[model samples]
Target: MLIGSLLDEINKKIQELMGKYVILDAYYIRLAVYKAMNLQGTRKDSSITFMVDDVFYVLQKCIRRGISSLNTDCICTVINHANNILLTEYTEALKKNLSASNWTAVSQHLLQGELNNVSGRVQSENAQKKYITHLNDVESSTSCIIILHNESSEILQKMYLSDPPKRLKVLSCLEAFLQTAKFFDSLLSETLLKTCSTIFYKLVDNMLQGLLDLRYVISDEELLMTEVNDPFMHAFCDGLKQVMQPFKKYMTDTNYAKLCRILMPYIARSYEKVVMQMKFNYNGALRLDKDVQYLLSFLTNLTGISVRNKFYRVLQITCLLTFEKAEEAKEFLLIESDTERWPFTNKEAREILTLRTDYSEEIEQLL
Candidate 1:
C-alpha cells in the first residue's frame, strides 16, 4: 500500500513535467523507465521485468492532454520532437527489450492527435466565417501543410536511403502526407496548388533513382526471360503510381499533360523490353504484361484526350503483338502503314511509334 502510494505520487510528478514540456518530457520519461528497470549497463536481459506498462499509461495520458491544450505552432513542435523520438530513441530502446507495442501506442497517439488537431483547425478556420477570419485561416492552413510536408519528406528520405529499406513505413508516411495535401487542396484550392506541385515534383525526383533501378531491371532481357514475377519492379511502380494519385485532382491540365509526356517514354521503353522478352518466354511475358497494363491504366486516367487516344492505339498494337498471330499482325501493319486508312494521322502515328523502337521495328517487319 505504501509502494502504491509512492508510485501514484511519482506518476503525478511525471504528469506535471509532461504538462510543462510535453516533447522533452517524453524523452525524460523514457530515460527514467530505463533507469527504473536498472538497464543502465550490461545487465540487459530478454524480458521487461519493470513496470514499463504503467509508465506508458501515464505517458499516453500526458500526450493526450498536452495535445488537446496546445496551439498549432506548439502542436507542430511537439509532433516534430515526437517523430525524432520515434525514429531515434524508440528504435534503439526497442532493441533493448522495451515494450514496442506501448511505444507504438504512444507514438501513434501523438501522430493521430496531431492529425486531428490540424484537421480540426483547418475545418474551423475554413468554416463559413467572416472574410478576415477566412483569410487568416487560409494562411494558417498553408503553414501547417508546409510543416507536414517537410516532416513527411524526412520520413520518405530515411525510408528511401535505409539499407534494405522500410517499404511499409515509406508508404505509410507518403499516404499521411497525401492526406494533408488533399485537405489543403480542398480547403485552400489554387493558392496551395503551386506549393503542392513543388512537393510532388520533389517526391518524384527523390524516387527517380529507384525508378531508374527498376528500369535497368526491365531492360535486362535475360532476367525478364527467367523471372516470372518481378516483385521489386511491381512494388516500385505501384509506389510511384500511389504517390501520383493525389496530384491528379489538383494538377492543371497543362501540368498533367507535361507529367504524362515525361512518364510515357519510360512506360514505352519498358513495354518495348517486355515485348522483346515475350518473343522467347511466354510465361514471364504474362507477368510483365500486367505491369504494363497497370501503368497504362494509370496513364489513361491522368492523361488528356490526345494522349489517351494515342495510348489506346498503342494498346491495340500491344494486343496484336501478344497473340503473335502472323496474319493479324500483318493486317495491323498494312492498315497502319496507309496514311489515309490509319486510325491516327500520319504525324500522330509516328509520334506514338517513336515512343517504342520495338513497335516501329515490328511494324517495319510486317510492311
Candidate 2:
C-alpha cells in the first residue's frame, strides 16, 4: 500500500515538473524515475514490473518523437531499475539454491535475449561477459557527447541531450558503466581484475586524449574556450580516477604498478606541455600542487610506496627550483611515487632542495 502511494506521488511530481515548460531538462525526468523506482522496491514484483514497464514505455516514446524533455534522469532511472530489480530477483533465486554463476549468466541471457537484433544481442553478450565492456562503451559514448556538449552554452547542451536523445543514450550508458563496475568488483576474481585494468587504461587514455582533441576542435571559438578548462578536464580525470579505485582495491601493488605504467607516459607528456609553458626564469617557478596531489594520491592508493621517500623527493625539487632554473627537475617532482623513481642523483636533488646560499661544501661533497 505504501509503495503504491509512493509511486503515485513520484509520478505526480514528474508530471508537475514536466508541466513547467514546454519540455523539461532531461535530468529532472531521470530524477523522477529514480525516485519512483526507489519507492517501487518496497513492493512485490508485479507492482514493480508495472512501474518499470510504464517508465520504459514512456521514455522509448519520447526517444522516437525526439522529445528530449525526457532527459538522462529518466533513462538512468530505467537502467538502474532494471539492474536493481534483476539483481534482487537473482539474489532471491540464489537463496532458493541457484548457482551464483548460473544466475549471473542466465540473467545476462535474459536481458540480452529480449533485444530483437543481432547487434544488440552481441552488445548485451559482451556487456554481460564482463561489465568492463559496458564501461568502455559508455566511455566512448561520453567522449562523443563531450564533443557536442561544448558546441553551445552548457544550458543548451543540457537541453539538447536531455530525454530520449543520442546524448542521453550516451549518459545512461555511462551510468550503466558505473553500476556494472560496482556489481562486478564485489565478485573479486583475478580475471575480473585483469579485465578492469585493461578497461581502465584504455578508458583513461581515450578520455584524456579526447579531451585534448576537444580543445583543438573548438580552438577557433572564444566562448567555448572555458569548456576545456579545469572543470571539464577534472571531470574526465575524476572519472578515470574513480574507475581505478576498484582495481586498486582488489589487486593493490601490481594493479597500481600497472596503472602507473599505463598512465605515466600520458601524464608525463601532458604535464610536460603545461610545465614547459610556465616560465622558470626569476621568481616564476610553477606551483604544481593540484595536479601533483591528484597524481600522487592515485599512486599511493594503488601502491605501498613509502611516504617518507615520496615527500622528501618532492621537497628536494621544490627547494632546487628556488635557486636554479631546472624544468626537468620540476617534471620529476610531479611524478607519482609509484612511477619508477628516476635516477636523479641524490646529490643533485639535495643540492636543489637545499636552497642554501653557502652550499659550496654540500656541492663539493657530491663531486
Candidate 3:
C-alpha cells in the first residue's frame, strides 16, 4: 500500500509536468506557425520558404518533447494545439494574403508579357516572384503535412505504440492536418485559375487566333502557301515557352500538372471556338490540320499529357472539312471514332462542313 501511494504520486507529478510542458510550448508553437506565414520577409527567389521548414521543425521538436513522458494523452495535447495553430494562424494568413493579391485580376488579358490597360494588377517581376512564392508556400505546406504525418506515424510505430490499432488511434489526431492540406490545395488551384487561364487565353487570342481570324483565307493559293510554322505561331510557341518557364521553376510537379490540366481545356475550348468561327476552304483545312498538329505536339511535349482528346472537336471539324468523300467521313465518324465519345453529333458535323468555303453541296450530306 505504501509503494502504491508513491507510484500514484509519481504518476500525478508526471501528469503535472506534461501539462506544464504543453502550456509552456503552446505559445512558441503558435508563434512558430504564425511566423511561417511571414509574407513580408519571405524569399523573393520563389522557392519554398525556410519558414515552412522552421514551422515543422519546431513542431517536430515539440512532439519529441511531448512524447518523452510516454503519455498518449500528453501527445494528444500537443497535437491538438498544433492542429489548431495550423488551421487558424497558418491557414488564415495564407487566405488573407491570397485575398488581397487580387488574384482574380492578376493576369487579365496579359499579352506579349504586357498587361492590358484594363488589368489592375501590374505583372511586375517582383510581384510575380512574390505571388509565386505564396503559391510555393501553399504547395510546400501541403507536402510537408504529408511528410510530417508519415514521420509522426513512424515515431509512434517504433517508440510509442507497438499495436497498430492504438498507433492508428493516435494517428487519427494527425488527420486534422489533412484538412489543412486540402485547404491549401484549394488555394493553390484558385490562384492558378486566376492567373494562368487568362494569360494562356490571351496568348491564344493574340498569337494563334489573331492570325487565323484575320480574314486571310480569301483564296486557295494563299491558304496553300501558308506554312505550318508561321512566324505568328513560332512567336506563340516562344510566348508559350516563356509563360511556362516560371511555373516549371517554382511550382511543385503535382501542382504544375494541375496547372496544365487547368490551361489545356481552356485552350482547347478557345481553339474550338475560333475554329468554328473561321471560314476554311480545302487548302485552309489542310493547313489548319497541320497547324493544329504542330500546336498539339508542342503542348504535349511540354506538359507530357495527351491533350488530343481535349481538342477532339477541333480534329473532327478538320476531318469533316478536309474529307474527300461524304460516305468516308460518315464511316469515320460512326465507326472509327467512339460513338459515345464523339464530341459532335451528325447534325453538328454537317454544320461544321458548311464552314468549308470550297466544299461541294454533298459535303453536308455526311449524315
Candidate 4:
C-alpha cells in the first residue's frame, strides 16, 4: 500500500510539473515518471502493471498537450524507454488494455521527431551531400530503410493528404528512398521504383513548376541575374541529379527509357521558354551568354534526342548573336553534333540524327 501511494504521488507530481513548467521542468517530470514506472520492479511484480499504466497515461496527457511542450531530449528518452517496455513487457497486454489512439499518437510523435532530426541535420550544402552519402551506407545496412519501409504506407498517405509545407517536410526523406533504390539489386529496385514512381513524378512536377513560375515575377534581366547569382536553380538541379544518381546502376533499359520519356518534354518546354525569352531580349549584347551557358551545362547532362535537339537549337541561336565568337560556336557544334561520339547507342544515335535533320532547314533559315 505504501509503495502504491508513493507511485500515485509521483504520477501526480509529474502531471503537475508538466502542466506548469512544460519544457523547463521536463527533466524532473521524466525522472519522476521513470521512477514511478519502476521497470525493474515491474518485471518481477505483476501488481506494478497498474503503476506502469499510470506512467503511460501521464505521458499520453503530456503528449496530448503538444509534443513541442516537452524538451526534445526528454521526449526522446521517454519514447525510447517506453518503446522498450511496450515492445517487451506489455505488447500483447497493452493491445487489450491501452487506448489505441494514445498509443498511435505517441508512436507518430516519436517517428516525426526522429524524421525531423534527420531533416534538421542536413540543411547546409556540404551537409546535404554528406547526408546523402550516409544514406547509401545506412540503407545498405537495412537499418534506416527498414524503419522507413515499416511506415512507408502511412507516410505516403500522409504526404498525399498534407498541405504543401507539411508534405515537403515528409518528402524530405526522399534521399533515403533513393539510397534504398541504389543498393537494391535490379529486381527489387524495379519493384520499389514502380511503387515510388508516382511520388517522384509529382515531386519533379512541382519543382519544375516552381522554376517556371519565376518568369511571372521577374523581368528578363532580373531572371538572368537570378539564374547567375541565386542558389535556387542550383539546388533544384542538384536535387534532380541526386534522384537520378542511383538509376545509372539499378534502372533497367526499359525503365530508363520510360524515365527519359517522362522527363524530356518538361525539360524541352522549360528550355524553349528560357531560350525564347532570351531571344526576345537579345540586342546583340553578350550579357546573357553566361545565363545561357549556365543552363546549358546542366541540361547537357540529361539524355534524349528531344533534349539534345533543343540544346542544339539554343546553341545555334546563341552562335548567331553578333557578340558570340564564331570560332567557339563552330567548335562546340562540331564536337556536340558528332552522332558517333554521343552518349546514346548506335541505334539511338541514328534515330536522333534522323530527327535532327527535320530542324536543320529551319535552323539554317534562322542563321
Model 1 poorest ten-residue lDDT run: 126-135
The full ranking of all candidates by lDDT, starting with the best, is 3, 1, 4, 2
Q: What is the lDDT of residue 271 in candidate 4?
A: 52
TM-score of each: 0.29, 0.26, 0.85, 0.28
Residue 77 in model 4: lDDT: 37
Tens digits of per-residue lDDT for model 2, 1-367:
9999999999888867644532353444455444443332212322112333433344344333333445444444433443443245422422232122232443334333456677765554433433322222223222322332233223334665534465555454435534444443343234334443444445555555544333211222432344335464466657655545443543334335544454545444444334323323222222233334555565555454533344444534434554443443444455632356553565544544333333323444433
| lDDT of each candidate versus the true structure | 0.44, 0.41, 0.72, 0.42
lDDT of 2: 0.41
Task: State residue 54's C-alpha deviation in candidate 4, in Å.
Answer: 55
Off by over 4 Å in 1: 1-196, 205-228, 241-288, 295-317, 320-327, 333-362, 365-367
> Over the stretch 1-367, how does candidate 3's per-residue lDDT look in tens digits?
9999999999999888878887888987887666655636554554766677777788888877777767788787888888787777777776676566553344443444356453423354345555666677788888888777778877878874456766666778877768777877888888788676556666666665675545534466677456633665567778788767767776667777888999888877887777877886666777778778888999898887899988887877787777756566667777855667777766677778777766547665545
| Best-performing candidate as measured by TM-score | 3
Model 4 bad stretches (over 4 Å): 1-201, 211-230, 273-280, 283-289, 302-307, 310-367
lDDT (Cα, tens digit) per residue for candidate 1, span 1-367: 9999999999787667645776565566567544544432221331122333333333344334434542333334444443444334433443343222222233223323443577654443322122222222333333444554565455445534643334344344334434544553444444234333434444444444443344322345655553666565566556556545433443434445545565555445444543333332232234445555765666565554344443554465454444434445456656666655355554544333333434445644543
RMSD to the native, candidate 3?
Answer: 3.6
Q: Pick the candidate with the highest lDDT.
A: 3
- Model 3 scores a TM of 0.85
